[model samples]
Target: MSDTAAAEAPSPSVRSLLIMAVPAILVGVGSALVLWLLDLMSEGLQHILWTTLPQSFGATEATPWWIFTVLTVTGAAVGLVIWSVPGHAGPDSATTELVEAPLRPGVLPGLLLATVIGLAGGVSLGPENPIIAVNSALAVALLARFVKAIPLPLAMMLASSATIGALFGTPIAAALLFTGAVAAAKGGGALWDKLFLPVAAAGAGAVTMHLLGGKALSFQVTPIDQTDGWMLLWGLLVAAASALIGILLAWALPYVHRGFHALRNPLLISLAGGVVLGLLGMWGGPMTLFKGLDETTELLRHPGDYSAGQLALFAGVKVLALLVAAAAGFRGGRIFPAVFIGVALGVLAHVLFPGIPLSLAIACGCLGIVLAATRDGWIAIFLGAALVGDPVVLPMLCIIVLPVWLMVTKAPELVVHAQPESAAAKA
Candidate 1:
């Protein structure tokens, strides 16, 4: 055996690692497929749903009261399942856990069901990680049934790699996300993992999306470069606002996480939660109602067409939607929504402070949320600038991300909630 292989395999030898990696490859590919398919179905489902929402009865300026009722009822059905099911609902997930969870092949059904309920039932959650849970459960169940000899770690690694590749919308991002998550989990020998599997999976996912002609998460716009010297000040202002918003959002997470924990009647609890969110949705526009990443893309794509009321309405609504989504029984990602919120906030800044370039405001706004979500200045910088697609905004994204990141870190107590362990150990 080669010295490198001998030293680095998850197992004792290069041969064993190679043997294990085959299943990992299957996992990566399959996970990509499932992730895309589930999201496609869920998004379609959500679309059909919005049309049916009971807004016609009491047509008001924003979301009506019936929107709350429908949301509550939908949440109640989902809550019933969560209340009955064990090992699902209301906890940090596999990615967030930083570790591979205990493998129970039987758990896939519960996880997927809960996730469907989460997305379809009006919760503002993302599908990527939940798909990981469902996929992990499915893999475990299938392996135990058909391939009893497969090592647990191999199964999990494959599943995770696939999930990462497909969900992040790129293989590279998937590799980084999974690697970071694994490191946070503290799994030794995880560094030995190759990027090949995840990359292949990302290709598979992209292929699937293209095949379906599905609307992609990203809408890379033609960047507008009209940068001015005034952006330095603009970055600072956006950073400060982001910090304030971040701190408040962080402060609310515990209460939000805890509220779900304390509810007695799970269905009614979700209903009540739904009502609160419904009310909040009244403030944030319909774009803020769901996860809002796609809606944000739609908004940015046609920003010139929207009137001032339209933009202001979205700004207020997104903040409330995020709060409502978290407070209720819905599950999903936050950073993307936070980015949208940041952009809308930046849009608000554009309206208020006409001197700062709109592109700079957009950059600082989006990055500020990323900084809050990850507490990573570097990632924040890249994401913020990349999102706006404007070179002029790049400098400000870098400058402002640091201050916001620093502010997020300053209040360390709230940031570290319940850290889950790495999957490699358990797997």
Candidate 2:
């Protein structure tokens, strides 16, 4: 065709989406499998560490000293892996952007190992980042061999969407999380059109999770009695306070990270991190350890079980643990820890003011911390409402985000921004 004729042709007909549908679905399913596998491996290892091994040792419950020893040893193992393993166990988790270039094929195994070790060893982070990176890398490598027409960027999106969907047990979370980024990109198309494949992949991923009996990230909070204008104001205060707390951590995270970096030895820094984390775990109890998924449920299952002081201690120590874990070079994401902190904070709110509904307080607490950590208002609101599994909480979270956004807008992000040379080195 002539140049004008080709230029005038619309880019991929709107109805031609079927061409990419199969690939998207396949990528989503593949991503979900990887996520499931990671969960299984981590949980199996944790079972041994927390249960079988302790039973073998004749302990009924893991003592604080046991917890301390386990964490310290886990840290040393991770440090050794990073020190001797190829790919340096992938990039430093503290400095890597959430979504970046797909990792080299050779680097994926080390990354996977480090992630599993972190999860099983009670590292205070979620599987979000590593799973996404792993899936992205695998998707790109797999697609290039079989489906060369699919672009790398689109492969990245499909993989990311799939992993996110599987992680949360829904495509809605994935869609909502990426909506902002998609809308902001330069393109000549409807937003939904751009989101079609991602949504397809996400739907498949969510379905895969259901098929595999993957745990959904949800809570069974009591339904709100009746939302009111007063509730909105109350939510605003709660969310703002929580966001401020998160922001304070965000500000301090970099300095602490650098302080650890000053040691200039991955083994020592990570070991020290593990030791500090062990002490924190000893002080805070088991609730503050690991990624916050199961612990969040534990908190909700017995909301009144913890006293005001214990609740406060849980929140503070979890935040500090999260900071130390990330700063000290563990491979994980902030969302789970943030969710745990939010839960503790919400419980604290209830303790301080008994009148507030438990569900609402939890939602607001999640809202503030999520908003601050992600620096994304929409995600924060989604997480808040999703955590409680209540649609009624959405409007209140929406209203509360307005204030939370203002507080976090100027605050430093939870990630440490590396210098150009360091960034290149990481890549």
Quantify all predictions' global Cα lDDT against the true fold.
Answer: 0.60, 0.86
Clashes of 1: 12
Q: Write the per-residue lDDT of candidate 2 for residues 79-117, one digit (tens) a residue.
A: 777766778778778877667789998888888998899
**Model 2: clashing residue pairs?**
none
Index of the highest-lDDT prediction:
2
Give one digit per residue, the lDDT tens place, for model 1 in 1-427.
5656645546335665566556655666676677767777766666555654444554432455545655666677666665666544534431253234644545555566666656764555556556766677666667667767675665565566566555545555555555554454433354535444445555555454455454444445445556555667777787678657766776776676566545545555566667776666654545656666677787667766666677777766665566556555454556666777777776667767767666666777777666766666655666566566676666666666665666788653222255352231122
**lDDT, residue 78, model 1:** 63
Q: Choose the strongest candidate by TM-score.
A: 2
